[model samples]
Target: MNEMGKTDTVVQPQSSLLELKKMFFLYLPVCIGGYIVFRVLIVLPLWFSSSTEQLSVLRIIFIILGVGALAVVVLGAVRAPRWVEKPIHVHYRHWAPAFFATLVILGSIGGHLVASAKINSNLALEKVKAHFEKETAEYKMGRNAQ
Candidate 1:
Protein backbone atom coordinates (compact mmCIF):
# COMPACT_ATOMS: atom_id res chain seq x y z
CA MET A 1 0.00 0.00 0.00
CA ASN A 2 1.11 3.54 -0.80
CA GLU A 3 0.54 6.77 1.12
CA MET A 4 -2.71 7.20 -0.81
CA GLY A 5 -3.83 3.71 0.27
CA LYS A 6 -3.52 2.26 -3.24
CA THR A 7 -1.40 -0.80 -4.26
CA ASP A 8 1.34 -0.45 -6.93
CA THR A 9 2.85 -2.94 -9.36
CA VAL A 10 5.94 -3.03 -11.55
CA VAL A 11 5.86 -4.84 -14.89
CA GLN A 12 9.01 -6.41 -16.26
CA PRO A 13 9.88 -6.09 -19.95
CA GLN A 14 9.60 -9.34 -21.94
CA SER A 15 11.89 -10.57 -24.69
CA SER A 16 10.20 -11.14 -28.04
CA LEU A 17 13.01 -13.32 -29.39
CA LEU A 18 12.69 -15.71 -26.48
CA GLU A 19 8.92 -15.80 -26.97
CA LEU A 20 9.36 -16.50 -30.71
CA LYS A 21 11.82 -19.32 -30.07
CA LYS A 22 9.38 -20.84 -27.61
CA MET A 23 6.59 -20.66 -30.17
CA PHE A 24 8.68 -22.42 -32.80
CA PHE A 25 9.76 -25.15 -30.38
CA LEU A 26 6.11 -25.65 -29.39
CA TYR A 27 4.34 -25.49 -32.76
CA LEU A 28 6.84 -27.26 -35.05
CA PRO A 29 6.63 -30.51 -33.10
CA VAL A 30 2.84 -30.44 -33.15
CA CYS A 31 2.83 -29.92 -36.90
CA ILE A 32 5.29 -32.78 -37.39
CA GLY A 33 3.20 -35.08 -35.21
CA GLY A 34 0.05 -34.27 -37.12
CA TYR A 35 1.84 -34.96 -40.37
CA ILE A 36 3.06 -38.35 -39.17
CA VAL A 37 -0.34 -39.34 -37.81
CA PHE A 38 -2.10 -38.31 -40.99
CA ARG A 39 0.38 -40.21 -43.12
CA VAL A 40 0.27 -43.36 -41.00
CA LEU A 41 -3.39 -43.51 -40.04
CA ILE A 42 -5.09 -42.29 -43.20
CA VAL A 43 -2.74 -42.32 -46.17
CA LEU A 44 -0.85 -45.51 -45.48
CA PRO A 45 -3.88 -47.75 -45.28
CA LEU A 46 -5.46 -46.31 -48.39
CA TRP A 47 -2.17 -46.64 -50.20
CA PHE A 48 -1.77 -50.29 -49.32
CA SER A 49 -5.34 -51.14 -50.25
CA SER A 50 -5.10 -49.48 -53.63
CA SER A 51 -3.27 -51.06 -56.56
CA THR A 52 -1.77 -47.98 -58.23
CA GLU A 53 1.09 -45.56 -57.57
CA GLN A 54 0.97 -43.39 -54.39
CA LEU A 55 3.37 -40.62 -55.41
CA SER A 56 0.57 -38.08 -55.42
CA VAL A 57 -0.25 -38.86 -51.79
CA LEU A 58 3.26 -37.98 -50.77
CA ARG A 59 3.03 -34.67 -52.65
CA ILE A 60 -0.33 -33.87 -51.03
CA ILE A 61 1.06 -34.55 -47.57
CA PHE A 62 4.07 -32.32 -48.24
CA ILE A 63 1.78 -29.50 -49.38
CA ILE A 64 -0.45 -29.80 -46.32
CA LEU A 65 2.49 -29.73 -43.93
CA GLY A 66 4.10 -26.77 -45.67
CA VAL A 67 0.89 -24.77 -45.59
CA GLY A 68 0.29 -25.66 -41.96
CA ALA A 69 3.77 -24.52 -40.91
CA LEU A 70 3.45 -21.31 -42.90
CA ALA A 71 0.12 -20.56 -41.24
CA VAL A 72 1.50 -21.23 -37.78
CA VAL A 73 4.50 -18.97 -38.32
CA VAL A 74 2.37 -16.20 -39.74
CA LEU A 75 -0.02 -16.39 -36.81
CA GLY A 76 2.83 -16.32 -34.36
CA ALA A 77 4.40 -13.27 -36.03
CA VAL A 78 1.07 -11.41 -35.92
CA ARG A 79 0.22 -12.32 -32.32
CA ALA A 80 3.65 -12.01 -30.74
CA PRO A 81 3.39 -8.26 -30.41
CA ARG A 82 0.01 -8.58 -28.64
CA TRP A 83 1.62 -11.00 -26.19
CA VAL A 84 4.71 -8.84 -25.60
CA GLU A 85 2.92 -5.50 -25.74
CA LYS A 86 5.87 -4.13 -27.76
CA PRO A 87 7.14 -4.13 -31.32
CA ILE A 88 9.35 -7.02 -32.41
CA HIS A 89 12.77 -6.29 -33.78
CA VAL A 90 13.66 -7.43 -37.25
CA HIS A 91 16.46 -9.78 -36.21
CA TYR A 92 17.73 -12.61 -38.42
CA ARG A 93 18.29 -15.01 -35.49
CA HIS A 94 14.80 -14.35 -34.22
CA TRP A 95 13.14 -15.29 -37.50
CA ALA A 96 15.66 -17.73 -39.02
CA PRO A 97 13.67 -20.91 -38.43
CA ALA A 98 10.53 -19.53 -40.00
CA PHE A 99 12.54 -18.26 -42.93
CA PHE A 100 14.22 -21.63 -43.37
CA ALA A 101 10.89 -23.42 -43.33
CA THR A 102 9.50 -21.01 -45.89
CA LEU A 103 12.51 -21.64 -48.08
CA VAL A 104 12.00 -25.38 -47.86
CA ILE A 105 8.36 -24.99 -48.84
CA LEU A 106 9.30 -22.90 -51.85
CA GLY A 107 11.97 -25.41 -52.87
CA SER A 108 9.48 -28.26 -52.75
CA ILE A 109 7.04 -26.32 -54.90
CA GLY A 110 9.76 -25.67 -57.45
CA GLY A 111 10.82 -29.29 -57.48
CA HIS A 112 7.25 -30.39 -58.16
CA LEU A 113 6.98 -27.94 -61.03
CA VAL A 114 10.21 -29.17 -62.57
CA ALA A 115 9.17 -32.78 -62.25
CA SER A 116 5.80 -32.11 -63.88
CA ALA A 117 7.44 -30.32 -66.79
CA LYS A 118 9.87 -33.18 -67.36
CA ILE A 119 7.05 -35.70 -67.37
CA ASN A 120 5.07 -33.62 -69.87
CA SER A 121 8.08 -33.19 -72.15
CA ASN A 122 8.74 -36.92 -72.07
CA LEU A 123 5.14 -37.60 -73.10
CA ALA A 124 5.44 -35.17 -76.00
CA LEU A 125 8.66 -36.80 -77.21
CA GLU A 126 7.03 -40.21 -77.08
CA LYS A 127 4.12 -38.88 -79.15
CA VAL A 128 6.50 -37.48 -81.78
CA LYS A 129 8.41 -40.74 -81.93
CA ALA A 130 5.17 -42.66 -82.51
CA HIS A 131 4.10 -40.34 -85.31
CA PHE A 132 7.49 -40.68 -87.03
CA GLU A 133 7.28 -44.47 -86.84
CA LYS A 134 3.77 -44.43 -88.34
CA GLU A 135 4.85 -42.21 -91.25
CA THR A 136 7.84 -44.42 -92.04
CA ALA A 137 5.62 -47.55 -92.03
CA GLU A 138 3.12 -45.90 -94.43
CA TYR A 139 5.94 -44.86 -96.75
CA LYS A 140 7.32 -48.38 -96.83
CA MET A 141 3.93 -49.92 -97.48
CA GLY A 142 3.12 -47.48 -100.38
CA ARG A 143 6.51 -48.05 -101.96
CA ASN A 144 6.02 -51.81 -101.84
CA ALA A 145 2.56 -51.48 -103.46
CA GLN A 146 3.90 -49.29 -106.29
Candidate 2:
Protein backbone atom coordinates (compact mmCIF):
# COMPACT_ATOMS: atom_id res chain seq x y z
CA MET A 1 0.00 0.00 0.00
CA ASN A 2 1.21 3.53 -0.82
CA GLU A 3 1.58 6.32 1.78
CA MET A 4 -1.42 8.08 0.15
CA GLY A 5 -3.64 5.07 1.02
CA LYS A 6 -3.46 3.86 -2.60
CA THR A 7 -2.22 0.39 -3.63
CA ASP A 8 1.30 0.46 -4.99
CA THR A 9 1.69 -1.52 -8.12
CA VAL A 10 5.27 -2.50 -8.98
CA VAL A 11 5.99 -3.61 -12.51
CA GLN A 12 8.74 -6.19 -12.81
CA PRO A 13 10.40 -7.17 -16.04
CA GLN A 14 9.33 -10.66 -17.10
CA SER A 15 11.95 -13.29 -16.56
CA SER A 16 13.30 -14.72 -19.79
CA LEU A 17 13.90 -18.30 -18.74
CA LEU A 18 13.31 -19.62 -22.25
CA GLU A 19 15.70 -17.12 -23.72
CA LEU A 20 18.33 -18.08 -21.21
CA LYS A 21 17.91 -21.75 -22.04
CA LYS A 22 18.18 -21.00 -25.75
CA MET A 23 21.33 -19.01 -25.17
CA PHE A 24 22.91 -21.91 -23.34
CA PHE A 25 21.91 -24.26 -26.10
CA LEU A 26 23.47 -21.99 -28.69
CA TYR A 27 26.64 -21.70 -26.67
CA LEU A 28 27.18 -25.47 -26.60
CA PRO A 29 27.42 -25.82 -30.38
CA VAL A 30 29.70 -22.81 -30.67
CA CYS A 31 31.99 -24.17 -28.01
CA ILE A 32 32.13 -27.56 -29.69
CA GLY A 33 32.87 -25.99 -33.04
CA GLY A 34 35.64 -23.91 -31.56
CA TYR A 35 37.14 -26.96 -29.90
CA ILE A 36 37.11 -28.89 -33.16
CA VAL A 37 38.67 -26.05 -35.10
CA PHE A 38 41.41 -25.53 -32.56
CA ARG A 39 42.21 -29.22 -32.39
CA VAL A 40 42.31 -29.81 -36.14
CA LEU A 41 43.69 -26.63 -37.58
CA ILE A 42 45.90 -25.07 -34.93
CA VAL A 43 46.93 -27.89 -32.63
CA LEU A 44 47.44 -30.56 -35.28
CA PRO A 45 49.60 -28.43 -37.53
CA LEU A 46 51.76 -27.23 -34.67
CA TRP A 47 52.10 -30.76 -33.41
CA PHE A 48 53.28 -32.06 -36.76
CA SER A 49 55.94 -29.42 -37.34
CA SER A 50 59.43 -30.56 -38.33
CA SER A 51 61.25 -27.73 -36.61
CA THR A 52 61.65 -27.36 -32.84
CA GLU A 53 62.27 -23.63 -33.21
CA GLN A 54 59.02 -23.24 -35.09
CA LEU A 55 57.14 -25.37 -32.56
CA SER A 56 58.50 -23.35 -29.67
CA VAL A 57 57.41 -20.13 -31.33
CA LEU A 58 53.97 -21.61 -31.91
CA ARG A 59 53.73 -22.80 -28.32
CA ILE A 60 54.39 -19.32 -27.04
CA ILE A 61 51.78 -17.86 -29.36
CA PHE A 62 49.15 -20.41 -28.36
CA ILE A 63 49.83 -19.87 -24.68
CA ILE A 64 49.50 -16.12 -25.03
CA LEU A 65 46.24 -16.36 -26.96
CA GLY A 66 44.78 -18.87 -24.55
CA VAL A 67 45.61 -16.72 -21.54
CA GLY A 68 44.25 -13.62 -23.27
CA ALA A 69 40.96 -15.31 -24.01
CA LEU A 70 40.63 -16.43 -20.39
CA ALA A 71 41.38 -12.95 -19.17
CA VAL A 72 38.68 -11.51 -21.39
CA VAL A 73 36.14 -13.94 -20.02
CA VAL A 74 37.06 -13.13 -16.45
CA LEU A 75 36.97 -9.41 -17.05
CA GLY A 76 33.62 -9.61 -18.79
CA ALA A 77 32.11 -11.57 -15.93
CA VAL A 78 33.42 -9.13 -13.36
CA ARG A 79 32.09 -6.13 -15.27
CA ALA A 80 28.66 -7.55 -15.96
CA PRO A 81 25.69 -5.23 -15.47
CA ARG A 82 24.01 -4.97 -12.08
CA TRP A 83 20.83 -6.59 -13.26
CA VAL A 84 22.73 -9.80 -14.10
CA GLU A 85 24.62 -9.87 -10.82
CA LYS A 86 23.50 -12.58 -8.45
CA PRO A 87 22.67 -11.88 -4.82
CA ILE A 88 25.55 -12.19 -2.40
CA HIS A 89 23.83 -15.07 -0.67
CA VAL A 90 23.96 -17.24 -3.82
CA HIS A 91 27.03 -15.81 -5.50
CA TYR A 92 29.27 -18.80 -4.91
CA ARG A 93 26.74 -21.30 -6.17
CA HIS A 94 25.88 -19.14 -9.17
CA TRP A 95 29.53 -18.88 -10.13
CA ALA A 96 30.20 -22.62 -10.08
CA PRO A 97 29.15 -23.21 -13.66
CA ALA A 98 31.28 -20.40 -14.96
CA PHE A 99 34.24 -21.66 -12.99
CA PHE A 100 33.85 -25.14 -14.39
CA ALA A 101 33.50 -23.83 -17.92
CA THR A 102 36.67 -21.81 -17.58
CA LEU A 103 38.53 -24.79 -16.21
CA VAL A 104 37.45 -26.93 -19.14
CA ILE A 105 38.50 -24.32 -21.65
CA LEU A 106 41.87 -23.85 -19.99
CA GLY A 107 42.43 -27.57 -19.63
CA SER A 108 41.71 -28.19 -23.29
CA ILE A 109 44.11 -25.46 -24.32
CA GLY A 110 46.81 -26.91 -22.11
CA GLY A 111 46.26 -30.36 -23.44
CA HIS A 112 46.63 -29.11 -26.99
CA LEU A 113 49.85 -27.38 -26.15
CA VAL A 114 51.37 -30.38 -24.46
CA ALA A 115 50.32 -32.82 -27.15
CA SER A 116 51.52 -30.57 -29.96
CA ALA A 117 54.86 -29.91 -28.36
CA LYS A 118 55.56 -33.59 -27.84
CA ILE A 119 54.59 -34.56 -31.37
CA ASN A 120 56.49 -31.69 -32.91
CA SER A 121 59.62 -32.42 -30.94
CA ASN A 122 59.52 -36.06 -31.94
CA LEU A 123 58.89 -35.21 -35.60
CA ALA A 124 61.76 -32.77 -35.65
CA LEU A 125 64.16 -35.28 -34.13
CA GLU A 126 63.18 -37.92 -36.63
CA LYS A 127 63.67 -35.52 -39.53
CA VAL A 128 67.14 -34.60 -38.30
CA LYS A 129 68.06 -38.24 -37.97
CA ALA A 130 66.81 -39.00 -41.47
CA HIS A 131 68.75 -36.12 -42.97
CA PHE A 132 71.94 -37.22 -41.26
CA GLU A 133 71.50 -40.81 -42.42
CA LYS A 134 70.90 -39.68 -46.02
CA GLU A 135 73.99 -37.50 -45.99
CA THR A 136 76.11 -40.32 -44.49
CA ALA A 137 74.95 -42.77 -47.16
CA GLU A 138 75.75 -40.33 -49.93
CA TYR A 139 79.26 -39.75 -48.51
CA LYS A 140 79.97 -43.52 -48.35
CA MET A 141 78.82 -44.00 -51.94
CA GLY A 142 81.02 -41.14 -53.15
CA ARG A 143 84.09 -42.61 -51.42
CA ASN A 144 83.42 -46.06 -52.92
CA ALA A 145 83.11 -44.59 -56.47
CA GLN A 146 86.30 -42.43 -56.17
Candidate 3:
Protein backbone atom coordinates (compact mmCIF):
# COMPACT_ATOMS: atom_id res chain seq x y z
CA MET A 1 0.00 0.00 0.00
CA ASN A 2 1.36 3.41 -0.98
CA GLU A 3 -1.44 5.82 -0.41
CA MET A 4 -4.30 5.80 2.10
CA GLY A 5 -6.09 3.04 0.12
CA LYS A 6 -4.28 2.50 -3.20
CA THR A 7 -1.87 -0.38 -3.67
CA ASP A 8 1.76 0.27 -4.70
CA THR A 9 2.93 -1.36 -7.95
CA VAL A 10 6.23 -1.68 -9.79
CA VAL A 11 6.60 -0.34 -13.36
CA GLN A 12 6.62 -3.05 -16.00
CA PRO A 13 8.43 -2.96 -19.36
CA GLN A 14 5.76 -2.99 -22.09
CA SER A 15 8.27 -2.98 -24.96
CA SER A 16 9.00 -6.71 -24.88
CA LEU A 17 5.39 -7.75 -25.08
CA LEU A 18 4.69 -5.07 -27.65
CA GLU A 19 7.62 -6.13 -29.78
CA LEU A 20 6.71 -9.80 -29.61
CA LYS A 21 3.14 -9.10 -30.57
CA LYS A 22 4.30 -6.79 -33.36
CA MET A 23 6.59 -9.45 -34.76
CA PHE A 24 3.85 -12.05 -34.63
CA PHE A 25 1.32 -9.89 -36.42
CA LEU A 26 3.85 -8.87 -39.06
CA TYR A 27 5.02 -12.39 -39.89
CA LEU A 28 1.78 -14.26 -39.31
CA PRO A 29 0.93 -14.66 -42.98
CA VAL A 30 4.46 -15.53 -43.96
CA CYS A 31 4.66 -18.22 -41.31
CA ILE A 32 1.41 -19.74 -42.48
CA GLY A 33 2.46 -19.63 -46.12
CA GLY A 34 5.83 -21.22 -45.46
CA TYR A 35 4.27 -24.00 -43.44
CA ILE A 36 1.69 -24.62 -46.15
CA VAL A 37 4.44 -24.96 -48.74
CA PHE A 38 6.47 -27.22 -46.51
CA ARG A 39 3.48 -29.41 -45.77
CA VAL A 40 1.91 -29.65 -49.21
CA LEU A 41 4.75 -29.10 -51.66
CA ILE A 42 7.87 -30.42 -50.01
CA VAL A 43 6.79 -32.91 -47.36
CA LEU A 44 4.02 -34.47 -49.41
CA PRO A 45 6.22 -35.06 -52.48
CA LEU A 46 8.93 -36.52 -50.32
CA TRP A 47 6.45 -38.87 -48.71
CA PHE A 48 5.04 -40.01 -52.06
CA SER A 49 8.50 -40.57 -53.52
CA SER A 50 9.71 -42.68 -50.61
CA SER A 51 10.11 -46.44 -51.00
CA THR A 52 7.67 -48.82 -49.35
CA GLU A 53 10.03 -49.56 -46.48
CA GLN A 54 10.52 -45.85 -45.79
CA LEU A 55 7.01 -44.74 -46.71
CA SER A 56 5.71 -45.06 -43.18
CA VAL A 57 8.36 -42.78 -41.79
CA LEU A 58 7.84 -40.17 -44.46
CA ARG A 59 4.11 -40.45 -44.13
CA ILE A 60 4.40 -39.70 -40.43
CA ILE A 61 6.56 -36.70 -41.16
CA PHE A 62 4.07 -35.44 -43.71
CA ILE A 63 1.17 -35.90 -41.34
CA ILE A 64 2.99 -34.06 -38.57
CA LEU A 65 3.94 -31.17 -40.79
CA GLY A 66 0.43 -30.94 -42.19
CA VAL A 67 -1.14 -30.97 -38.76
CA GLY A 68 1.30 -28.41 -37.47
CA ALA A 69 0.71 -26.10 -40.38
CA LEU A 70 -3.04 -26.42 -40.02
CA ALA A 71 -2.80 -25.68 -36.33
CA VAL A 72 -0.68 -22.60 -36.90
CA VAL A 73 -2.94 -21.20 -39.56
CA VAL A 74 -6.04 -21.87 -37.53
CA LEU A 75 -4.53 -20.32 -34.45
CA GLY A 76 -3.41 -17.26 -36.36
CA ALA A 77 -6.85 -16.85 -37.85
CA VAL A 78 -8.48 -17.26 -34.49
CA ARG A 79 -6.27 -14.64 -32.97
CA ALA A 80 -6.36 -12.27 -35.93
CA PRO A 81 -8.88 -9.93 -34.39
CA ARG A 82 -6.43 -9.18 -31.65
CA TRP A 83 -3.95 -7.51 -33.96
CA VAL A 84 -5.59 -6.85 -37.31
CA GLU A 85 -7.20 -3.47 -37.84
CA LYS A 86 -10.20 -3.05 -40.09
CA PRO A 87 -10.49 -0.18 -42.53
CA ILE A 88 -13.25 2.38 -42.31
CA HIS A 89 -14.52 1.48 -45.76
CA VAL A 90 -15.98 -1.95 -46.45
CA HIS A 91 -14.38 -3.91 -49.29
CA TYR A 92 -13.41 -7.41 -50.46
CA ARG A 93 -9.78 -6.52 -50.02
CA HIS A 94 -9.76 -7.69 -46.45
CA TRP A 95 -10.97 -11.18 -47.29
CA ALA A 96 -9.09 -11.59 -50.55
CA PRO A 97 -5.86 -13.00 -49.19
CA ALA A 98 -7.49 -15.65 -47.04
CA PHE A 99 -9.95 -16.48 -49.81
CA PHE A 100 -7.23 -17.04 -52.37
CA ALA A 101 -5.10 -19.05 -50.03
CA THR A 102 -8.06 -21.28 -49.21
CA LEU A 103 -8.88 -21.68 -52.86
CA VAL A 104 -5.34 -22.75 -53.65
CA ILE A 105 -5.31 -25.17 -50.76
CA LEU A 106 -8.55 -26.80 -51.83
CA GLY A 107 -7.52 -26.89 -55.43
CA SER A 108 -4.26 -28.60 -54.64
CA ILE A 109 -5.96 -31.24 -52.50
CA GLY A 110 -8.69 -31.88 -55.05
CA GLY A 111 -6.19 -32.13 -57.87
CA HIS A 112 -4.09 -34.61 -55.96
CA LEU A 113 -7.11 -36.77 -55.13
CA VAL A 114 -8.38 -36.82 -58.70
CA ALA A 115 -4.97 -37.52 -60.16
CA SER A 116 -4.29 -40.37 -57.76
CA ALA A 117 -7.69 -41.89 -58.49
CA LYS A 118 -7.07 -41.78 -62.22
CA ILE A 119 -3.64 -43.32 -61.89
CA ASN A 120 -4.92 -46.14 -59.67
CA SER A 121 -7.81 -46.84 -62.00
CA ASN A 122 -5.49 -47.05 -64.97
CA LEU A 123 -3.13 -49.35 -63.08
CA ALA A 124 -6.01 -51.66 -62.16
CA LEU A 125 -7.27 -51.75 -65.72
CA GLU A 126 -3.81 -52.62 -66.97
CA LYS A 127 -3.59 -55.44 -64.43
CA VAL A 128 -6.90 -56.87 -65.53
CA LYS A 129 -5.95 -56.71 -69.20
CA ALA A 130 -2.62 -58.38 -68.52
CA HIS A 131 -4.31 -61.16 -66.59
CA PHE A 132 -6.69 -61.91 -69.46
CA GLU A 133 -3.92 -61.86 -72.01
CA LYS A 134 -1.77 -64.21 -69.92
CA GLU A 135 -4.67 -66.65 -69.57
CA THR A 136 -5.34 -66.66 -73.31
CA ALA A 137 -1.67 -67.17 -74.15
CA GLU A 138 -1.34 -70.11 -71.71
CA TYR A 139 -4.46 -71.81 -73.15
CA LYS A 140 -3.28 -71.34 -76.73
CA MET A 141 0.20 -72.71 -75.95
CA GLY A 142 -1.18 -75.81 -74.23
CA ARG A 143 -3.69 -76.56 -76.99
CA ASN A 144 -1.13 -76.08 -79.79
CA ALA A 145 1.41 -78.44 -78.08
CA GLN A 146 -1.13 -81.20 -77.53
Candidate 4:
Protein backbone atom coordinates (compact mmCIF):
# COMPACT_ATOMS: atom_id res chain seq x y z
CA MET A 1 0.00 0.00 0.00
CA ASN A 2 1.31 3.53 -0.94
CA GLU A 3 1.16 6.28 1.58
CA MET A 4 -0.71 9.48 0.62
CA GLY A 5 2.46 11.56 0.98
CA LYS A 6 4.70 9.30 -1.13
CA THR A 7 4.56 9.10 -4.95
CA ASP A 8 6.85 7.22 -7.32
CA THR A 9 7.73 9.25 -10.35
CA VAL A 10 8.82 7.62 -13.61
CA VAL A 11 11.40 9.39 -15.73
CA GLN A 12 12.16 8.41 -19.29
CA PRO A 13 15.58 9.14 -20.77
CA GLN A 14 15.62 11.36 -23.84
CA SER A 15 16.37 9.57 -27.12
CA SER A 16 19.29 10.37 -29.39
CA LEU A 17 16.83 11.91 -31.80
CA LEU A 18 15.73 14.39 -29.20
CA GLU A 19 19.37 15.32 -28.64
CA LEU A 20 19.80 15.93 -32.36
CA LYS A 21 16.64 18.03 -32.43
CA LYS A 22 17.91 20.07 -29.52
CA MET A 23 21.23 20.73 -31.26
CA PHE A 24 19.60 21.50 -34.60
CA PHE A 25 17.23 24.01 -33.06
CA LEU A 26 20.06 25.43 -31.02
CA TYR A 27 22.36 26.49 -33.87
CA LEU A 28 20.19 26.71 -36.99
CA PRO A 29 18.15 29.75 -36.11
CA VAL A 30 20.79 32.07 -34.82
CA CYS A 31 23.69 31.10 -37.10
CA ILE A 32 22.01 30.18 -40.37
CA GLY A 33 19.23 32.63 -39.70
CA GLY A 34 21.75 35.33 -39.00
CA TYR A 35 23.47 34.58 -42.29
CA ILE A 36 20.22 34.58 -44.19
CA VAL A 37 19.13 37.66 -42.34
CA PHE A 38 22.31 39.44 -43.36
CA ARG A 39 21.68 38.59 -46.98
CA VAL A 40 18.16 39.95 -46.71
CA LEU A 41 18.52 42.96 -44.48
CA ILE A 42 21.92 44.18 -45.62
CA VAL A 43 23.27 42.71 -48.84
CA LEU A 44 19.97 42.74 -50.72
CA PRO A 45 19.40 46.38 -49.99
CA LEU A 46 22.88 47.25 -51.23
CA TRP A 47 22.65 45.12 -54.34
CA PHE A 48 20.86 47.71 -56.47
CA SER A 49 22.16 50.79 -54.74
CA SER A 50 23.70 53.29 -57.15
CA SER A 51 25.76 55.22 -54.61
CA THR A 52 28.05 52.53 -53.37
CA GLU A 53 31.04 54.73 -54.02
CA GLN A 54 32.00 54.91 -50.37
CA LEU A 55 31.52 52.99 -47.13
CA SER A 56 28.60 55.25 -46.52
CA VAL A 57 26.01 55.63 -43.79
CA LEU A 58 23.56 53.27 -45.49
CA ARG A 59 25.88 50.28 -45.09
CA ILE A 60 26.17 50.90 -41.38
CA ILE A 61 22.42 51.32 -41.11
CA PHE A 62 21.81 48.01 -42.87
CA ILE A 63 24.34 46.25 -40.67
CA ILE A 64 22.51 47.54 -37.63
CA LEU A 65 19.26 46.33 -39.12
CA GLY A 66 20.79 42.92 -39.78
CA VAL A 67 21.87 42.78 -36.15
CA GLY A 68 18.30 43.49 -35.13
CA ALA A 69 17.11 40.65 -37.34
CA LEU A 70 19.75 38.40 -35.82
CA ALA A 71 18.54 39.34 -32.34
CA VAL A 72 15.00 38.30 -33.22
CA VAL A 73 16.23 34.99 -34.61
CA VAL A 74 18.26 34.26 -31.50
CA LEU A 75 15.01 33.62 -29.63
CA GLY A 76 14.09 30.85 -32.07
CA ALA A 77 14.69 28.17 -29.46
CA VAL A 78 11.78 29.38 -27.38
CA ARG A 79 9.18 30.51 -29.91
CA ALA A 80 9.49 29.21 -33.44
CA PRO A 81 6.28 29.18 -35.53
CA ARG A 82 4.07 26.18 -36.35
CA TRP A 83 5.36 25.92 -39.88
CA VAL A 84 8.83 25.27 -38.52
CA GLU A 85 7.71 23.30 -35.46
CA LYS A 86 5.66 20.91 -37.59
CA PRO A 87 8.75 19.72 -39.40
CA ILE A 88 10.57 18.96 -36.17
CA HIS A 89 7.62 16.99 -34.86
CA VAL A 90 7.17 15.06 -38.09
CA HIS A 91 10.84 14.45 -38.77
CA TYR A 92 11.93 13.45 -35.29
CA ARG A 93 11.27 9.79 -35.93
CA HIS A 94 13.22 9.33 -39.12
CA TRP A 95 15.30 12.29 -40.28
CA ALA A 96 16.17 14.45 -37.28
CA PRO A 97 19.56 12.88 -36.55
CA ALA A 98 20.67 12.72 -40.16
CA PHE A 99 19.50 16.26 -40.87
CA PHE A 100 21.29 17.59 -37.83
CA ALA A 101 24.47 15.75 -38.88
CA THR A 102 24.22 17.18 -42.39
CA LEU A 103 23.83 20.69 -41.02
CA VAL A 104 26.90 20.14 -38.88
CA ILE A 105 28.87 19.20 -41.97
CA LEU A 106 27.58 22.12 -44.05
CA GLY A 107 27.22 24.87 -41.43
CA SER A 108 30.53 26.58 -42.12
CA ILE A 109 29.55 27.62 -45.63
CA GLY A 110 26.81 29.83 -44.26
CA GLY A 111 29.23 31.20 -41.70
CA HIS A 112 31.65 32.06 -44.45
CA LEU A 113 28.95 33.91 -46.34
CA VAL A 114 28.20 36.02 -43.30
CA ALA A 115 31.85 36.76 -42.77
CA SER A 116 32.39 37.55 -46.43
CA ALA A 117 29.39 39.86 -46.56
CA LYS A 118 30.75 41.92 -43.72
CA ILE A 119 34.30 42.04 -45.06
CA ASN A 120 33.98 42.06 -48.83
CA SER A 121 30.88 44.02 -49.80
CA ASN A 122 32.22 47.47 -49.14
CA LEU A 123 35.68 46.65 -50.45
CA ALA A 124 34.23 45.38 -53.69
CA LEU A 125 32.14 48.49 -54.09
CA GLU A 126 35.14 50.68 -53.42
CA LYS A 127 37.12 48.85 -56.07
CA VAL A 128 34.38 49.46 -58.62
CA LYS A 129 34.16 53.09 -57.59
CA ALA A 130 37.90 53.54 -58.08
CA HIS A 131 37.83 52.01 -61.54
CA PHE A 132 34.94 54.22 -62.59
CA GLU A 133 36.63 57.32 -61.27
CA LYS A 134 39.81 56.50 -63.17
CA GLU A 135 37.87 56.07 -66.39
CA THR A 136 36.02 59.35 -65.80
CA ALA A 137 39.30 61.17 -65.23
CA GLU A 138 40.76 59.75 -68.41
CA TYR A 139 37.70 60.77 -70.42
CA LYS A 140 37.86 64.31 -68.99
CA MET A 141 41.55 64.65 -69.98
CA GLY A 142 40.83 63.44 -73.53
CA ARG A 143 37.87 65.82 -73.88
CA ASN A 144 39.93 68.77 -72.61
CA ALA A 145 42.70 68.00 -75.15
CA GLN A 146 40.27 67.92 -78.10
- Enumerate residue pairs that collide in model 2: none
Off-target runs (Cα >4 Å) in candidate 1 are 1-62, 79-94
- Give the CA lDDT, 0 to 100, for residue 116 in model 4: 50
lDDT of 1 by residue, 1-146 (tens): 88999888776655877757766676666456545543453333233422112344545655776687687568647644343444343233345456555655554565445434444565688899999999999999999999
Q: What are the models' TM-scores?
A: 0.46, 0.47, 0.42, 0.29
Q: Write one digit per residue (lDDT tens) for candidate 2, span 14-128.
A: 4567446655665566567555654554445444655656666656666666676677568758855464554332333344444544644565576556757676678888999
The residue ranges of model 3 lying beyond 4 angstroms of the native Cα positions read: 1-85, 88-92
Give the distance in Å from residue 110's predicted Cα in candidate 1 to where it truly belongs.
1.4
Q: In model 3, how many backbone clashes occur?
A: 0
Off by over 4 Å in 2: 1-17, 46-48, 82-108, 119-146
Q: Candidates' lDDT values, in order?
A: 0.56, 0.61, 0.52, 0.51
Residue 119 displacement (Å), model 1: 1.9
Model 4: ten consecutive residues of lowest lDDT? 100-109
Q: Which candidate has the top score in TM-score?
A: 2
**Model 3, span 115-142: residue lDDT tens:** 3554556578889999999999999999
In candidate 4, what are the lDDT values of residues 94-138, reduced to their tens digit?
343343333332333343344456447767888999999999999
Candidate 3 residue pairs in clash (backbone atoms < 3 Å): none
